[model samples]
Target: MCHIASGWLYGGICRSKLRRHYSLPEAPCSDSLIHCCCRACALTQEYTELKIRGVDPSIGWKANVEKWNREGLEPPIVAPGMAR
Candidate 1:
């Protein structure tokens, strides 16, 4: 149940990233439809896209952000601060 519910969000996010990476004006189909039809393929494509773009998705997002910061690139999103 949790997987099904979260699928919608991840599917849309993957599709959005693909569109942004390719500067696409519109997608060939909706994210949910594509994911529903072949989720593995969609995930593979997203993973490949990340690998080709030099992001190691095996590493967590915060680590990736720290890496980008070390490289002198501003992170796309800011990390939240921890309160004591």
Candidate 2:
């Protein structure tokens, strides 16, 4: 998703296109443009968010769903649906 968004920022580095038609500036695009510049930090932020929410991203989504069902807990896979 971040990669898709970088185009408007004229970003093509990191998770972006890696191709060029116009010159890209050597500055940050937007406050949320982490993936186009700092991928590690972006990943860390996601990991931290999951940890803070008590959701282990290392576990596959399906496994989490199964575990939630077994434990009678609500699953964390609700956002991807709700975002739509």
Candidate 3:
């Protein structure tokens, strides 16, 4: 179920964040289309983006929040449906 949600639902969000964080210009196409066309590349890009931002995607969300709190940094703001 988690895998399904991540692939089907969260893929676009990940790409959006990568684009926004790097200040990349809008793509000529939508993220879903990109993901559909090149899933491996899209997922790799997303993983690399998270690593570049110092977020370990392997760790669960709660651990990430705890890490942020311990470091005296606030976690990134959550979108409505993304709250865990």
- Candidate maximizing lDDT: 3
State residue 12's C-alpha deviation in candidate 3, in Å: 2.4
Q: List the pairs of residues colliding in candidate 2.
A: none
lDDT of 1: 0.71
Off by over 4 Å in 3: 1-10, 17-24, 74-84
**Candidate closest to the true structure, highest TM-score:** 1
lDDT of 1 by residue, 1-37 (tens): 9886688668877787766655544457877677878
- Estimate every model's Cα lDDT from 0 to 1: 0.71, 0.52, 0.72
CA deviation > 4 Å runs, candidate 2: 1-32, 76-84
Taking all chains together, the TM-score of candidate 1 against the true structure is: 0.62
Selected candidate, larger lDDT, 2 vs 3: 3
Model 2, global lDDT = 0.52
Which RMSD values do the candidates have, in order?
A: 10.1, 11.6, 8.0
Give the distance in Å from residue 43's predicted Cα in candidate 2 to where it truly belongs.
Answer: 0.2
Candidate 3 vs. true structure, TM-score: 0.60
